[model samples]
Target: MAQDSARQAPAAPAAPARALLASFLPALAVGIGSSVLYLLMSGLAERLQEVLWGPLPDALGIGPYSAVWILVMLTATGVLVGLVVWKAPGHAGPDPATLGLTAVPLPVGTLPGLAIAAMLMLAGGPSLGPENPIIGVNVALAFWLGHRLAPRAPGPLWPLLAEAGTIGALFGTPVAAALVVSEALAGRPMRGALWDNLFAPLTAGAAGAMTTSLIAHPTFDLGLPPLGHPGWADLLAAVVIACAGALLGLTAVYAFPHVHRAFSRLGHPMLALPLGGLVLGGLGVLGGHLTLFKGLSEVKELAHDPGGWTAGQFAGMAVVKLAALLVAASCGFRGGRIFPSVFIGAALGLAAHALVPGVPETLGIAAGVLGMLLAITRQGWVSLFTAAVLVASPTIIALLCVASLPAWLLVTGRPQMQLKEDGTAIR
Candidate 1:
């Protein structure tokens, strides 16, 4: 009788356990693939420097390769962009503004564009970062896997969840990446089962963490200052710093798209990239060696050892980096703004610190990263997470909440690009 009643009643069937696994499987593949890709790309970027620039140490009577890296990177990037523009289906490639850390199912074809572009840009010395490529490659791989394993995923937006999870896992911060995914999906009403949502993030995050560990043992040290008890002054300063970051971000948002558009409109991809290379070369000549490539060394030096550079040098490098970022991104170079922006912010913050002695280095660095992220991607959670993680200190945790205020305020509006349910873009 109980069985008959249970059968008769209109009960919702329990979801298949396999469905959950299938939904998250692509993310696992992407996480694994991306970890390998990151390792290779990181090595390639480093080796390209050692091989190409290594000889210059003795011949030039100077330190390292000097500013020639920009030329090298620009030429490589030009070739890569030319190939992508001519051969690739999506001429433009992965759009970070549209995807965030969320897994949006993109064609496998887009992956090559993103991968090559990132590698070249990094190798070529563009003021860009690897995170975007990491995201792009993984997201594409996941989508491809999803299509093969569970054909229904693209339709259900599982790709986006997987991406968020993978990113969270990659960064060793599931909650933070989840927050970014949620921010991207902010306006949308929840459609899937609660379990599906929960499991997807968990799997993706776990895969990312495992993959990262497998590739590169995680040993993150930011040389953070002790998080002292915050007095009213510190709180007040945080507010001021956050607001300053907002201003800086606003400037970047307004400038970046216009730069990209202007460069895209210039002649053929081949010619444009080379010309862009020339422009980058000229800028490098003017900006000093530190401004040539991705701002990693500069960021490391500035953050940990301020005395390594003079105030004039810091100010000059900041301008050069900012300009290099704009030019490289605008001129059809492939890479993400996240790293360059963070480095720029760090430099800017350090410069500010020199002027104002009271501001802690960690706090200033955090504020700069958040500010730049807000300006470039309009990703609130990303901006907040990046800033907090840069310090990697528990005391800075409270300030993360505080610093997020400006970013939250700035990025509160509806996204400029929206997508339809069928994976067709909606403006």
Candidate 2:
């Protein structure tokens, strides 16, 4: 009887594996759920955009791409979002400028208003991505569902899983999630092996990436020249361009609080949002379509034919996009700043290439993106990954890594782009 019991008992070492396998199913479900939610939210916004910019304008007899229509649509979008924030449940959660990528799960009741506001921002040409708000919604939904469906699951694990899943879906790759989460979790002491904690999140990220891929493929490729063998000249140019981009990003960082304070002084969403919309509209008028939206497509457009634009034009686009980003963020638009910063960096890099003539287009762009992202995100690994991913050139990776050293130094002790609860800089 004793021998039989011993044979039946599970080995202690197998516990980790068993736990990981057990967590996998819930993680996968959460990932898929997050992706589904993302798709639904994005789809709704896309349809609304079509209506606002396409059929509605045509029906009203306004030219589809008219600046007047753009102005009207953006201003109206701000008003609608403001109304939701003012009257909707939970006041749309919290000010996005005060939040980061991760936060405590919000109440399920707040999701509706948050979703509405985010959708409006997306469709309205805000210079922000859907990452921040969508991640909050996903985390809340995942936690709520987990409690009902899997009572035994750890409470803390749900947020991590949800964040990983949403990040994977956002970038359409698990690698980005891994890098970001790893960077966030680095230096924090934990009980288990790092990989052990990472297993569930990675599983979730993979599921999310696969699910998002079924609906649409995410591509950052700009079709730039392949970064070939790097010479001494290329390295020198990379550092110079990277520093330049970092300086520009720092300028925005310094101006962010002032701009945010200016908008907040209105003391009412109704007053603040419309005024912000007006400023953004004016910026759009100055910068044209290339400076609109979250900037993914616009970055690609700018890179497609770098020679088509003058140095002055590229500089103008960068400045205008940075301004749009600041205004959209401060005015209660719920979105992420990464995409807009990436766009600004790309434009700055193109301008550098135009002026220097010595820097390769791909190298200059990678360096510029690295520097700006470093300043904006304050994450070296994520910044490096973002810059290298744009060109997908192995030759540029070494150059980017080296250039990031100086860029990091410049931004290390500087004020971050985020704001505190009291609307002060988070320095």
Candidate 3:
């Protein structure tokens, strides 16, 4: 709330302190409201997926994950998404290639088209997550409505609250929202009382988390056996797996612009997206349905039955998922890379453990996720947080914190997966 209340520049006496109390109601509303929309989006997509992949496949007498069916569905999804991009207002919202985790709100006009495109992407099975567009949608809605509802609040206030709320809903926890938002605000010069400047956003995050928990009960725990204690070898496993995952992610990061340009050369979303869908279908066929969709559920599936897959199968899954993420993002899909990356990391981690029995499986997973998120998102706190959450072990938490250090170094100066309009890395 004190975004502009630096002691050096502020003229209002006790105003910054007063802002905290004044902001609580609006923050709570934004949090709860954003969580509602988040859940609605997820529910709509889940229902569509059940119909498309479940009933319709059975009714049509085709295996949903069969190679032929996978290709058709993905390719068809691409075309449907292409039509949305070509015909929908705001071109189905901005090209995801040129965006980050959060941005200033888009026009309310763009929301419907963006929502449709994102839902199609989710239900239609391109290896991506709801996070990016969901945040965009929530932020846009909050900014648009908050102005009319709270005319006296700062212009930046609404989006921040919504962003925090959406993130909290996504993770079903205020911890993630706090870490991520605080990380973003860390270096910016701001005047504030000792109380968290992120009070309003944090409040919104708590509300959102509580709302999501009440409704969905989502969790990150992958059901991996606990890493009860750390040892020297376990630490080494964490370091090696994390660094390996980072390198693997960087390969995709470096290749991102090339893949985007390759699609860009096709000259239009209508032309490029279908072909991208075709590629994703092939990947899905190779990786199986377990590697499809946002990786959260897939990772859980993989974790539950680690022994069901061989080392080679796990390795193939990881590579295919990474390739699918690259193609999906490059080809104009509206989603985030984070969830898919999680799938890749889980696959890779399991592969590592399969190849070398000495590495503790939980430690391997935490480190692998730590590395992948580091290279992909480049958000240190969020990376560490996500990796630790997956295993839900206090011991792995400490191990991942140590694992993140060298892993961070590997990705620090490298190109991020995000790009500019010209298809170059944003850095």
* Top-TM-score candidate index: 3
TM-score of each: 0.82, 0.94, 0.96
- In model 2, the runs with Cα more than 4 Å from the true position are 1-14
TM-score of 1: 0.82
Question: What is the Cα root-mean-square deviation between model 1 and the actual structure?
Answer: 4.7
Q: Rank the candidate models, highest lDDT first.
A: 3, 2, 1
**Please, what is the whole-model Cα lDDT of each candidate in the order they appear?**
0.64, 0.88, 0.89
lDDT of 1 at 4: 95
Q: Cα RMSD (Å) between model 2 and the true structure?
A: 4.2
Q: After superposition, how far is residue 18 of candidate 3 from its true place, in Å?
A: 2.8
Query: Which has the greatest lDDT?
Result: 3
Question: Per-residue lDDT tens digits of candidate 2, residues 1-427?
Answer: 9999999996665578898899999999999999989989988998997787789889999976678977887788789889988998898989988877786789999999999999998888878988898999999999998988888888988999999999889888888878877876786776577888789889889889889998877777888989889899998888988988898999988988998998898999998888888888888888987888889888998898999999899999999999999899998888888989999999999998898877778987888888888888887887888899899898898898889888888999899899999888787
Which candidate do you rate higher for lDDT, 2 or 3?
A: 3
Worst ten in a row by lDDT for model 3: 187-196
Candidate 2: residue 355 lDDT (0-100): 88
In model 1, the clashing pairs are 73-124, 103-159, 103-160
